[model samples]
Target: MREEYELEVLERYDVEVRSTRRIRGAFFCDTDRGTMLLKETALSGRRALLLYRALSRLEQKGNVKVDTPVFTEDGELLVSSAEGSVYMLKKWYQGRECDIRQEGELARAAKELALLHLELADSAEWSGGAKTGIGANDSTVPGGVLPVGRNPLDEIRRHNRELKKVRSFVRGRVAKNEFEYLFLDSFGKMFRIAEAVAARMENSGCMKLFSESCRRRDLVHGDYNYHNILMTKEGPAITNFEHMHVDIQAGDLYYLTRKAMEKNHWKQKTGQLIVDSYEKARRLSDAEREYLALCLAYPEKYWKTASSYYHSNKAWLPEKCVEKLKLAVRQTDEKYDFLAKTFGLIL
Candidate 1:
């Protein structure tokens, strides 16, 4: 199977494959074009090609250093595996992943992320139109103004409903494990946080602003953690756009900011620095600023822990789940502090 993939890449790109080794689901092959990484994705051929085109478009416009996929002999962007999986190959860029702890590195990453956001803010090239996972239910503003895009609060409401289900499941269990016990102990605090977040969205102009951003066709990395960033001498290169989606860029910005702050227990200083850095690249509007804080204030980690444990086989709870629940509880104050200090929230 390994040799088959390598041969396909070799014949397609016309590059000599010296050797191949597995790296993170993809095979890193030593080739004349430097180290080339070959990855098989579950995405259909059209979506895969669409993604390739988007990355190519970004690279060509000098918006960012996106590693472009190599074309096959037939001028196709993907190769097929024996089991009918799709494969993509691109140059294996040389650099270390961005370290969020290092202020300078973090700032650079934040700036690049902003630039990427700005670039994708209104990309006409991205054919993936405004995709609301659910139907676009109309939402009303204070003056009874109907926003143009989907109801943003629907997602918050949906998550809250899921949390309630998980809580109910944990309570109904015959013999609870240590993680379930921790969950039972922590559920109230988490529910309160979720309520607060929902309230913040309902009262604020968050939905209207996000609805406006929706019309902009802004793209998000979907998963924009530090690991996806490569610290090249040229600058930070964002890779792995397979998770890209069309959402209000604030979600991506919030993810990046939250991810950066989590390393330092939601330290206000670090959060401030990252937000400031991003602001320099592309300023966050009033709604986005407040919404980002609400996203942080939401007990996402706790919900994630509960959701994971609920979905898994309930023979026993893993030690890691307990540890995560504890971590979530321990960081609550710090998370609140970061939100309050950064956004001037009264909470």
Candidate 2:
């Protein structure tokens, strides 16, 4: 595969390649044109070509600063090799991933993301593809606000049953001292929260709020983590549109805050920094802020999702994993109160 890619590039560009190194299934090479990043994937040549074209369009519009691909003599953005891999080359921008702790970096990232969203919103010509981030309904109880199947409530009831089964499994494991009591206790608390939230969702009028909010769709970088943002001398440059999708602006905010909060290196203040920056740049409404608060209050959803992954593998996870879950639960309770008080939702 490497040799084939090398030959294809050699035949196309007529430039001498100096060295090649593989990083995350993509090849980084030192060539006469400077450092080039080449990605080879099993994706069809047409899809790869489409992405390259989208990147090209974004670069042309000054929305992104990226290495443009060197097209083949036949004007193809992607070339398929006989070995079943599509390959393309791009210019490598020199910069490190932004440090969440850096002064003004979080605010800068927020503003940049807002700009990207605005650029992608309602632009018919920018039909690069669908957005790719996580959605609110992804974790909702099967039969909750967003429809999952023929009956959403039935799905929630089914998940409730699974939760009960997990509780029983944890109880048995704890009795044998195979799992720590604290772990079981924490899981029990999370399960209760999930059940309560599911019930509220089923009986409350919050669905109206969610539906109204959904109408305000914008282009969101589904996964707006620090790693995907680059801190260049000019400013923060956004990259990795792999998870880019059209969704509520709140989804982007929720995922960004959640990721920052989960990081061990950053202090609690880091989460605040992101929120402050995002709020300043985007000017979220009081209602939008409350919605964000609601999302944070439901830590059980995240736990349930993680537990699914953990149980699926049945592998030993780090002690920190359990600690993080517990911390998230504690923080969720505190955040719920803080949000309620700030918004006068309880008073």
Candidate 3:
């Protein structure tokens, strides 16, 4: 019923829908205005406006194509149905998801990401060292606003504690499963690596870097994996800025690099290609480089798998968990080698 109601919601817009197709959890509508997508959203009013504003700003930049939100006839970014369901429409593009495995595509995506950072920086520019478009309470502002920046160092420390907690939980289990045994086997080494990386990050002046970046109001595409990027004929059309927020811009690069490397089995050339392509547009400062290397050094995959296992059903463990554990463990050597050769770090 809600799905059918979505079409009615589109009537709020002036365009006449000629056809509608469902794909990737979104409705692709061929409208009189152009291609548009309608999808249900749980975004709060503030968050929805934030995304709309960010994408609108990006749309102004000629080269950066984004799926900016389309306002309703009543000048609302979101429209509600009879049952209180909310939906947002956007100007969609004709394209497919970027293929991360292809080297050329990967390189193009990296460069495109760097270009995006430049635009996000421009949109988030600060004046006289004072922030803009940010309010005391985000809900108070309707024009949309960027949130306060977060320090990655704090997150790293918290993750470290969670890693220990998961380890203790697994150790307390007398009748351990295969995943538990493997986690125990790798816990000591992975923990040491985590600690070393955390210590290095603390001393790397990253806090100062983060503070300055926040003052500058730098923004990152919070979720920058391949799925968000569309491979259009014009080029990579970056979409979905919902998770976009103020943070160290390099964090986005780190995420893209890590995800691509993981898929390529921690290939050194792949890592180098990504960094090189990104550096072509925006170069990483010394501190940013160190920050990125340390971030990649931590056993994030290992921690995530164990954390998932700890919180899931223990009696009937999924086989995929064991496979993921083995893969994470097996990739340690390759990951370390890529880190050392590509970033010149020996941890």
Candidate 4:
């Protein structure tokens, strides 16, 4: 659409379009309407329309502070042209994304997340929708009565076989020197550690802890990273609620802390400030906190082992790929250490 036409659309709201760009098929336009974000999609237009309607309901119910778009003369949140593209507009929010490295940003963001959760708890349902945590092995869906096609243990055995093949390939092609040998040694040890942790969890009653802890289903921002949050002069303003879902609240905490530590910000006092602030706001039970620690540990184990294998094999790969893989391995180790210290899990 031309700038004039966009302006005409905004005229209903008594606003003027200043600038526009096609972002992911949506025109994100700067307008007197306060940073209007528009989306135009062909395949997902209907889904987008549903989402817009949901957002509208939340805004009307005072459950969310979203920009409710002004409807056209026909009173539709979506406008479909003959070209099959559906258009949508929303008021753009203004603020800088909180930096995870900043001292108080994580804490403030965590508190804001807790507040959002509390607000969501007031209403039994949210308009956007809820997600089911169904994995490939989940047998609760429509054809669930069938016997298991492949046991999870069998899958694990197959994966180990594949890993052995990859290890042989790496050793034959790249392990001609002492450095390569040391890398392979570390890789093997890390894999053993991962297996040990998984085995211990399976045998130790930790699975029950995980199951019980995950039973508390509340609306949580599935991707509550620092980048999705805005640091305003007033306080932290959350954005991008599109990935919101009903899940264990600790998952959100675990994800944010993991990401923050990846940026090397989790080692400092500022990182602890964020964690403590979030804890104060949400007040997690001791059991929940312990579960979070265990949840954090599993990722570290997998990443460390995977990184060692990939980096060791990278010697035989392209130079550019090796460089990138090495950097990623370093970052993974750093994050693992940071989280381990933060949660007081040395192993």
Candidate 5:
């Protein structure tokens, strides 16, 4: 029944499906042409087409290999299933998710991300010019233009607001749990760090860099994490460009470094290695380096934990939340050392 339902959506495509197997929530189809993954998506046709065009350019550059979205027989990037769900088929590769535990793999992923960003920026330049900020009405923007991401300074301010709101909620709670207690204890220090970073960002040339990048339509992977990177025999295949957008591009590096460092217990060596690996391919600008330092310095994990606890049912808090809160607090000190030794930010 499941295969029949999925096939109904896949039938719209021109591929001859020889076999199918379920992996995670998506179906892996072995077709006569090659391998493809059929999965439901909430992406609109216009946006998917935009992504497809950007990735196709990257493929031509021959630096990054991505799972390009396939169009249907009716010339649609997405096809509707019998049950009214939308699905997209992408040219899939046989490989495992990049193992973050291995430093070598992490370095490769970071370098690949740098290469991908270079191609994205170059493609943006080739696309004629920029568009309005990200999330603007797509109708207003001209076709074939990549959208810019929200400024990190603005994002940091918004996240700080959310942190304050969570703090207020927790303080008002009469009966607090371990997670809340850990949160309250860490709030003062973490919020201080957050505010400091925000202040540093405002004073630095970060905003200028963002403005220039936006004007140039510099692109970022938007979600360049371990899950989206595939470790293939040929090289690391960067997938899932549905979140791709124009930005400072260093934001992608910061995110990749953060995820890898978190897995490695915020080791200074590992963090420095990731940065060095990226710089080997593309050296970061001073503003980008500052932005990366500020991003790493901010207690993002703590803010997320507090935010999560405040939003969840207060009657029963999860133990893992408390553990995570503790980890966030503990690792933050280690992260500061990384920042100090790495980028020479004495904070």
Candidate 6:
């Protein structure tokens, strides 16, 4: 960013900037008070304030690791920038991301996530009259209503169709590269697996699972992974609430555990360790366990790899894409074994 532009955005925050450095699309501002993060966004005023309030409410409820948007002198969370762009200032924190390889960190992160989930769940509770939590008493917030509209199986069926479409698209290419060659070789197996998974999903009768979670107002941190968590002296501090939304909470648990499981070669012991640690915080019910099992049974990563290749602009596919397919195939194999052993069902 230009120095002149930097100074302009800094004026919105009530801090005296001593220095600035660019990091990961955000500027790190060293000010008299402390380090801060500044980034330009094209968010509308209404939407920005909604997210700002949600994040601040979470922090105020004792989830300090969640960085709340700083309010300007005029009481606005968003500051206007040059060219009409808006920006928000957040306090910068220093800590390393938790390493899942170590059992100590892994178990701690699990409990922290569970505690965080509990906080998020309780944040939606309404105790009559206006309360201290986020949209707690607001009945019109859509989160309170049961999410019974969509069938979860519909999504799997859609993805299954796309997989076949992409496979056919690749098969029709007159002259293809080595990546296409590798893709075609594994395409049949992956496609068959997707079809089977879709059939399994249809027969699982999991729509009630989705509705129950939403009716309880269990919010998910849309994107929960090791990268979004910081291993600080205070314990695990989760950051980046930009993707926070209301959803089935089990989805969040599954992603974090899947990330750890994938890293550990889909070993049952590692999966057991995570589930055991998390259950100590908030035990998973039998229905939730079944929902989580079905979620893990699907081959989402393989579908995404193929979908990404097809959607992105391309003259020739990259070699790394093919390499990822090879790794994905191997990972899917381990996942099947892990799921079969844990659930006593075919994956």
Which residue ranges in model 4 land beyond 4 Å of their true spot? 1-16, 21-27, 39-88, 121-123, 127-186, 196-217, 265-268, 299-341
Residue 66, model 1: lDDT of 76
- The TM-score that candidate 3 achieves is 0.93
TM-scores of all models? Answer: 0.89, 0.70, 0.93, 0.64, 0.94, 0.87
lDDT-superior candidate, 1 or 6: 1
Model 5 RMSD in Å is: 2.3
Per-model C-alpha RMSD: 5.5, 6.8, 2.6, 7.1, 2.3, 4.0
Q: Model 4 TM-score?
A: 0.64
* Stronger candidate by lDDT (2 vs 4): 2
In the range 197-289, model 2's lDDT, one tens digit per residue, is: 566556644454454433332445567878778788867766665444435566577766666555533244565666677666567766566
TM-score of 5: 0.94
> In model 6, what are the clashing residue pairs, if there are any?
none
Model 3: which ten-residue window has the lowest total lDDT? Answer: 133-142
Cα error, residue 158 of model 6, in Å, equals: 1.9
lDDT of 5 at 216: 60
lDDT of 6: 0.72
User: Least lDDT summed over 10 consecutive residues: which range in candidate 4?
Assistant: 143-152
Which candidate model has the greater TM-score, 1 or 2? 1
Task: Single out the weakest 10-residue window by summed lDDT for candidate 6.
Answer: 127-136
**Regions of candidate 6 where Cα sits further than 4 Å from its true position:** 1-3, 126-151
Q: Model 4 Cα displacement at 111 (Å)? A: 1.4
C-alpha-based local distance difference test score of model 1: 0.75
Rank order by TM-score, top first? 5, 3, 1, 6, 2, 4
Q: Kindly report the root-mean-square deviation of model 1 from the true structure over all alpha carbons.
A: 5.5
Residue pairs with backbone atoms closer than 3 Å in model 1 (clashes): none
